[model samples]
Target chain A: MAEKPKAFGERYMVKPGKSFRLADCDPRAANGFSDKDAAKADTVRDAAAIDALQDKLYAEGKRALLVILQGIDCSGKDGTVRAVFNHCGPIGVKVQPFKAPTADELAQDYLWRVHHACPPRGFIGIFNRSHYEDVLVVKVRGYAPPEAIEKRYDEINAFEKMLSDNGTKILKFMLNISKDEQAERLTERIEIPEKRWKFNPSDLEDRALWNDYMKAYEVALTRCSTHHAPWYVIPADRNWVRNAAISRIVRETLEEMNPKYPEPKGWDPKTVKVV
Target chain B: MAEKPKAFGERYMVKPGKSFRLADCDPRAANGFSDKDAAKADTVRDAAAIDALQDKLYAEGKRALLVILQGIDCSGKDGTVRAVFNHCGPIGVKVQPFKAPTADELAQDYLWRVHHACPPRGFIGIFNRSHYEDVLVVKVRGYAPPEAIEKRYDEINAFEKMLSDNGTKILKFMLNISKDEQAERLTERIEIPEKRWKFNPSDLEDRALWNDYMKAYEVALTRCSTHHAPWYVIPADRNWVRNAAISRIVRETLEEMNPKYPEPKGWDPKTVKVV
Candidate 1:
């Protein structure tokens, strides 16, 4: 038999206690797969495997998976979710998209909303954007004082460690797209009538500060990519590559978790009769 | 030109202001279909159509759909959701299963949690079991006073009406299965080790009160079914027919909702250029 392919989770993961730079990674890397069509087919197969594994997770009902997707605008967070989890049933998978916080949300610490949205045991919760926004947007926009923003990386690490201790596995993906690729996508949004609604003028303001966002992402990814929750910088310039890489990582992680159907205690099926 | 088949929503809907009897509806009814395989195939096609319509619903971001499923033990609520919504992306569809209320939930009105769980505009929220439990299990188990229980039907009607008035269309399904069918299913749950975790012994206790539960459902369906939120008594003993009938109704209702991508205002695509 051919040697097993290396797991994407290990290949793309941001290793803890290591020197890292966002610029060192290629946004358009194919991650070893050369053909787009073949990668797409593998993505579909991996997604189906994820769905099957999710069924066992649901049946076991003892642990949970929390997937966090963070990226720049038009980086395909939504598209990756649709491609990777399309085969998983709604019964077991949830997607929570974090946009602007409400007045109630802003009243509390930043993690309040994110914690409440975390998947309970036996479910897979995908965060479209997550608590890292506190570090990324807040640092870039100076929403918080520099001192407060600087302390959040440790706070986030501790929080994720607690969830890990409690049986909730976390996977974070930062969809890395080239500046040129983002420009093409933003342009397409303007030109396509059906896609026009997604085009926001404010996105251009952020586009001007791309370098600042990149620096913020680098700091966040490097500081918080701990053993409990690692961040993968997905090469997202190509939708197929992005989907395939994430799907493989997600499938491999679920397989490693290996949730099983629990045996009924002290009940023999032969003895139990429905009246 | 071929005349279109009448929508399953109209065919199975329990009309408001009409006397309804649960006994009159056959648990094994295939609606109009005779062949199980063909009906199953149509169900798969309808499910895909629902997914396509749901994409438009998400893009429109102006309206929502809430599907409420109420059923006794072994009536196949989970199975129906998996079959009808397997094609829908997690981004647009959510399944909220309402078990026994928590102490905090019990502190508020029964409608409080249900209201909070209602899908925001641009999404489909499915309740595996819902506020009807206040009228079903609560009534059958004598969890509330007769007077308190008596008022919930109208209160629920008003609550659903308010949601409908605020851009959330509601579809309620009562998964009706014969007593014999429930017994068979419950038996299988005991015999299959993979399914054993789902087999709770308390389910038998509820099964014993089958008649009372049936009466409770009849009253709730009769009193709470309204113009804004009609109740559909789905014949659910046969999983294929149950899936087919409900998928047709869900798709037809979404098609009628006719969500459209919004036309962008002020900015012309021709004038805007990506930097």
Candidate 2:
């Protein structure tokens, strides 16, 4: 038998698997879309298609989508959310940021607050920061005991499984921006007066633990990626590539769901005419 | 003073009011816009503004806005949400419909679930139906004892006041569809095949108890309308009028708040040159 052909993401039909890897696709590579010009064109087209599909999904109100953006601080999470969801409908979509739990939130089970905030049917919910914080930040910062951190992985898996079983389509994206890229972005923020408000001194402290965070994400993704809910490791150093990849992923997922307006049972269009 | 100026809506500047009467501003009247036409235009405009505002707010990581829509059944609650928020940005706006409380919801305090769902700052939250359900439906349906129903009004006032004090700009709209107009609409729904899905057999039962619901709403509006949080009585008989009135109220409120993009402190725009 001939050797298995190498995957050419641009020319080849990329069959979606239980999980996807951006590094494998390497959207930034010269061969990916012939040249930069071609890639940019593809990105615009992809973005438009995603917008259309999302609008149709909103109107139909058949499926609910959950997007989890996981990455280090300054990994372009905010920018990604803005660019990807800019053209989508507001009524059916929501973004929930999971920061440090409050006294009240801490009193409940970790997933209780999250369950309360889950998007209803026919909606899209984006978790800017998510439950992974229990394992990642709490683990790295020693806010929770080691035993507790270890247990949370199982809890997260169960939580996600329940969501999938209940018709939630989950797409987790980990924005992988290199340390050098992050430093450059942070410097630009500081040097550009208009962007100074985005800077926080504490982010530098978090940067020191970058490797720890990566390891945490790798383990999280490995343990949590399933047929119903999958994680995509997106190369986020290039904003255009990041946006294009996310748009494509979202479009592909939505296409798989094939959401359509449900005609009520026994309804006959011929029975009544529009006035 | 000159005879209190005939208390007609035309005499006023049409500035957004916290409260008003439905009969005074019917859009369909021979005036420039019938209530229905006006409401439609307002819905389009409000949807666009919300889209723009949501992007800015989400990026800024500021506070959230909760808009509550309360009206009689068939008073265009669903229609208003569908129209007014049709073009809004996806990331920051969320709409929740509080249907018959599930066993889980009933177990908690009346506001427990609602407080948990309030959008984070810089976001927009819409309640298709809201906590007012407790006062309106429970009272009308006799779900709660009279004493409990009476106490809920105070609880609602306090809860809403707390939301306003905490930076949630609450704009509640009570769609005042008249009895005759509702009958006409219900007839149209039954006659039109496409609209039949919207009509539930139970609506007829609810329709029979209109006066009871109206009384409960009056109480809710009187008690809950405060300095920070206010209610607007929208004429629902004319869909366009109601949409327009609600949109104008929101626009005026936002303008009053003056939601400017927060300039980064200590940042001089002149000093930062774009590369």
Per-residue lDDT of candidate 1, residues A1-275 (tens digit) = 11233365777888786878999989999888799999999999999999989988988989999999999999999899889997897888999999989999999999999999999899999999999999988888888999999899999999999998898999999999999999999999998888998888878888999999999999999999887788899999999999999999899889888899888866777787899
| TM-score, cand. 1 vs. native | 0.95
TM-score, candidate 1, chain B alone: 0.96
> Which stretches of candidate 1 lie above 4 Å from their native place?
A1-7, B1-6
Q: Report how large a share of the reference interface contacts model 2 reproduces.
A: 0.41
The true-versus-predicted C-alpha distance at residue A94 of model 1, in Å, is 1.6
Two-chain DockQ for each candidate model: 0.72, 0.26
Candidate 2 at A209: error in angstroms? 4.1
Best candidate (score: DockQ): 1
Q: How many collisions per candidate?
A: 0, 17
Best by TM-score: 1
TM-score, first chain, each model: 0.96, 0.84
